[model samples]
Target: MTKILVVEDESAIRSFIAVNLRRQGYDPVEAASGEEALAVMEQQQDIAVAILDVMLPGMDGFAVCRALRERFPAMGMVMLTAKGQEQDKVQGLQLGADDYVVKPFSPKELLARIESLLRRLERPTVELGSRQEASFTSGPFIMRPDQRKFYKDSREIELTPREFAIIKLFMENPKVALSRDDVLNSVWGKNYIGDLKTVDVNIRRIRQKIEDKPEDPKYIQSIWGYGYRWLGGD
Candidate 1:
């Protein structure tokens, strides 16, 4: 049986997911906080995935994720943060999170993202071993996808995971316009149900970090009615 762990504070949300995972034939374990999670995790082995909420009363989700990875490096981690907590989710990635699902998430969508993460984890890392190759360069920016880091003209730029993912997307497809929906589905996950403005906010944050003049960005060019694109300078 595939074991899964859910660390959420809310009783309803925790139970909701637990019941659903059980229905799907998964051996689900629930913990209300990071402390509780630790106590339970030791007893459970082969836990394939974990769904964790960002804010807990004590030992927030970020710390818990790191501890979990130390023990089960291969375990998939899905983070849940509030609607406006982009920074929190971004920080979570540094600790080795596989994916994130923002708050007000439907149980179904949560399950789907979980399944996708688990499936991706299921793939043998053999082909991925030692061969974790990635190379892409953008205007004034250097990308290391495997490491999820970005540098501007050799100066390291601290990009939030969301910012890094968005910038990476534009870099991979420079000069190609992408709509808000496209970005949401790709970076935020298709299960994202947040407002479109969330994209704009993240864009503004990224521009501030990458653009020489965020007030009038050149690389992350806006497309008016369409969206934005990375026009790497020549």
Candidate 2:
């Protein structure tokens, strides 16, 4: 059974989500606080997704998301934010969350987001039946799809699953200007119901990891009023 962690301080909301998850055949691990969520994670290493509520008793969802991203780069994360809290949504994404759900969201909507995340997490980094195509290099960066690893100048750089997918897409289509919509459809899928800002935020996060000066990125250059392009080569 697939395990999903639900961190919501409200008993009613937490129970509501857990019931829905159980109905869908997922094993829901409930945590009332961020601290408990971390404790649960320590024991439940098999947890594939974490649904974190932004308003928690202690150690807010942002902190938990950051810690989780640092400790478990591959684990999928979804933030539960109150409606109209745009900053919370952006902060969650910047902290390595794969997606966010606004308050008062239907169970179906939340489940859809979770399923989308699972699909991305389960996707093969490289196509099967092509051992020779398992790895690729662009300038100083090396990506091993089979191993799900990336390195810059021989040093491993930890990337969340979403970041890895975005970078892989960029590296594969070097020099081609890809609009935010293009990246959203390719990485997050066409069915994704989110703002285009998601693409921008992820790109910024990727730049922070891969570029020496994120403020003035050399490899991933933004095309004014359009999109972004990757300049591959040393």
Candidate 3:
């Protein structure tokens, strides 16, 4: 069964979410703090998604999100932040969270958001038998869809699942300027409701990984008012 890790310092909220998750036919793993969340992940191998609160006892949600993202690139992460705090939502996304639910959200709203994220997670990057091989090469970069990894100049570059998705999308449509909305819909799912700034954050993160100088990127080029385009070399 698919398990979801709910990490919240407040027992009341944690229990509420767990109960709802159970009702939704999903297994819930509860944790009172970030440390416990990490421990739970280590012990439970079936955790597919994590719902983390922005405020925690020990490590904050942003820190925990970054840590979990590094360890589990494919795991879906959703942060719970105070309503109306746009900065918190942006921070969570910058730390590689897949989605965020503001505080005071209804159970129905939260479940809907989780369902959207899960749909994205379950979506295959590339359908089998549609391609000759699960790989692509452009310029100095080489990607293997089967491995979900990136390589530049034959050197491995670590990328989160979202990062990998964005890179793949750009690579497949090189020289085309993709709008932020296009990227959000394609990568985060059409039902995703969040700041479009997330595209900027992930793009910056990708440049830091694949570019020699992130300040002056050569591959993913910004189009000012539009969005970005992949500049693949010969």
Query: Against the true structure, whose lDDT is highest?
Result: 2
**Can you write out model 2's per-residue Cα lDDT over 37-119, one digit (the tens) per residue?**
99999998999999999999879999999999988999999999999999999999999999999998999999999988898
Error of 2 at 152 (Å): 0.7
Q: What TM-score would each prediction reach against the true structure?
A: 0.57, 0.95, 0.91
lDDT of 3 by residue, 66-164 (tens): 999888888989899998998998888878887788889889988988887776566445556775346789999999876666899999887766787
Residue-level lDDT tens digits of model 1 in 81-165: 8887868766766566767788887778888877766644543222466686476886667887666557889988765445666
Steric overlap count per candidate: 0, 0, 0
How far is each candidate from the true structure, as Cα RMSD in Å? 6.3, 1.4, 2.1
Off by over 4 Å in 2: 123-133
Candidate order (lDDT): 2, 3, 1
Model 3 worst lDDT run, 10 consecutive residues: 123-132
Task: Write the candidate numbers in order of decreasing TM-score.
Answer: 2, 3, 1
lDDT of 3 at 9: 96
Candidate 1 collision pairs: none
